[model samples]
Target: MNGKGTKARWWARTATTFVCVGAAVAATAPSAFAGATGCNDRTCIAVAGSGLRVESVTASTTWNGDFNGHLHIYGGGIDRNSATGFWGYHQKFTVPVGRDLPNGSVLCAEGWEHTGGGLQLRGRACAEVHF
Candidate 1:
């Protein structure tokens, strides 16, 4: 066979091998998130000083990127499960406050990433803010 024809066949074989390996890797990979059931909990909000029941936790979402979205939390830990892209966590719930939480209640939250066969909370937290 001609040298040009031999080179073309070699390239075709290499491409086929690449595709096969990629497919195998994808098929064996685990999903990034565990679905929308990881963060569903019924917990009441409480006062800062006395730990009095105040309000509930509610989960919200907003666009953070074109191909990726963010989980915006106001109250407590809501549904923390992202259904797409790399990795994500989302949660939503309700908190009972004395008509309006009386303001000044601490709103603490954080998101995490699973790596190295363990969980790391990434320190993506929001501090003392009213919902």
Candidate 2:
């Protein structure tokens, strides 16, 4: 084969291989979130806590609206903290626990959403994890 034809075939094979590899990687990649708790029709919260200290909190929703909201961490004698912002779909917040929680204490993560304009449509969900 001529040089031009050989180069064209090589490029075609390389492109095909790259496309297949990319699709495989995408198929095997882990989902962005899992183990959702305290879920309603539109919102859900996931919390990971150790004793009186919370490790992480994830809030998620499926509401399709221009809304602002927050993720709140509470319980176990810890001061409640709200991480607020314009939220859509998912938000991850870190909880800063200043003291150790008492035994048998439970930590809860709450997700709240409200309309940005007048006549708000509010919704909330909460989930808890024990250390």
Candidate 3:
């Protein structure tokens, strides 16, 4: 109807289109460390070595006497799957990695537990450290 009305409508449509496009891009974007290492959560830990070796891997969950924990720590084409006899608040497993791993290698671990009901996942995370 008027110049002011037309400009306002155009701006609103442009903003809406930008927001939708941004959401789509974020949904399709890859993670910064895909399948690699991020130990942001307090429940999981990935213990890496100075070089290409990882000394140990640890995970934790709520203390449940009837639960047992399982950890799968892997990187650089190396994987270590381990389990615990009983469920404690913290569970650590040893994964002796040699010095043949490459730099910038990512180590990730998935932690789960065998509970009274069924198998439950604790958390999955990765961590990176340099010498």
Candidate 4:
């Protein structure tokens, strides 16, 4: 009945509407990194090489051991040393491509675990960069 009461009710309704809209949008929207590379099982990997001269590698492991493993990245114009002592739930590695990769170029990465004085495969993943 009062002006203040009407204004308060309007603000509350507006807030509720915004919340509902946000939830709806989130549910319907696709993943931001839907094209990202991913791996499964004891280890996981994701790569994004959309930038020039730099590529990102994300490696993760669920294995609880004395030594988690190492991240190896290869292919393209990027050649770097493997990451050692990759413990914990995840580890990130980066590679510089020196230049933009040609269209349909593929980059591969893998996680290796040390077992019984030998290296064993944990998880492997790869991604293709398109020019």
Candidate 5:
């Protein structure tokens, strides 16, 4: 009996299984800082403990002039939350050597909008720090 069809079907099943397992591992990786992310309609946030590098967070927003981005860390590693535009497009920031952080600290990013009243909080995203 010809076994070509059976071999092809077995190979397909094996490939499918591998793909599914790979995805599951990637999503539930032990490093929350390396796998986590937060997003909203106006913004997407990735912090030190998120999929982004452990030293920084990205204040992602539309490149339009109406939105301002801010980055902050809620961990003991930093002295204080950054002021407005500390990580903004207009400012030049240099990445320093990474620092060790106290366990369980969370890093967050906020998006602000230039409104008629004043700068109003638009959206925010956060990721918990994990070892």
Candidate 6:
């Protein structure tokens, strides 16, 4: 295999291991936040908004297995989702640092499901935040 392919496989393996460890930790841990939820689904988790100033946003989807959602930021600003035809998908976003959002700048994920779509959301997005 090529060097890129080998590196990708190694990364995937490491990521999978991290996910498993995270799951185990979550299963035994107790959360302090009342409104927080965690998953790889419709509502993933509650990101702490305390002292957080959002600076930017970016997202990506690795495979076409499940999700095809758009992120609605700050209420009205729309950021469409990305998909790689037949195999992969990806997306990126940018947000201002001081923009206010629900529950500390909520990023709403919305999508549709069909014959090729299931209910899983394997992809995620992240933003730079300053406290």
Which prediction has more favorable lDDT, 1 or 2? 2
Against the true structure, what is every candidate's RMSD? 19.6, 13.5, 10.4, 10.0, 8.2, 19.6
- lDDT (Cα, tens digit) per residue for candidate 5, span 74-118: 333542344465233334222231554555666555556555687
Q: For residues 1-131, write the lDDT of model 1, one tens digit per residue.
A: 69999999999999999999999998886523111211212121222322223333333322231213323345433334434234222333223333333334444333334455655443333323232
What are the per-residue Cα lDDT tens digits for candidate 2 across 65-106? Answer: 224766565665643645567756654455544444454555
Give the alpha carbon lDDT tens digit for every residue of 9-121 in model 4.
99999999999999999888653321356664455556654443335655555545224567677766655546577556644565544355655656666667777788887
Could you tell me which 10 consecutive residues in candidate 2 have the lowest summed lDDT? 30-39
Best by TM-score: 4
In candidate 2, position 7 carries an lDDT of 97
| Ordering by lDDT | 4, 3, 2, 5, 6, 1
**Using TM-score as the measure, what is the rank order of every candidate, best first?**
4, 3, 5, 2, 1, 6
In candidate 3, stretches whose alpha carbon ends up further than 4 angstroms from where it belongs are 1-42, 51-67, 116-118, 129-131
| Candidate 1: Cα lDDT at 11 | 100
Per-residue lDDT, model 3, residue 9, is 97
Whole-model lDDT, model 1: 0.37
lDDT of 6 by residue, 10-31 (tens): 9999999999999999987753
Candidate 4 lowest-lDDT run of ten: 31-40
On a 0 to 1 TM-score scale, where does candidate 5 land against the true structure? 0.48
Q: TM-score of each candidate?
A: 0.30, 0.44, 0.50, 0.55, 0.48, 0.29
Model 4, position 79, has a per-residue lDDT of 51
Per-residue lDDT tens digits for candidate 3, residues 9-92, read 999999999999999999886533212234433345546444445554454443342246676777667677776666455555
Which model is ahead, 2 or 5, in terms of TM-score?
Answer: 5
Worst 10 residues of 3 by lDDT: 33-42
Candidate 5 at residue 53, lDDT?
A: 40
Relative to the true structure, how large is the alpha-carbon lDDT of every model? 0.37, 0.55, 0.59, 0.61, 0.52, 0.40
The residue ranges of model 2 lying beyond 4 angstroms of the native Cα positions read: 1-36, 49-54, 63-66, 96-100, 115-124, 128-131
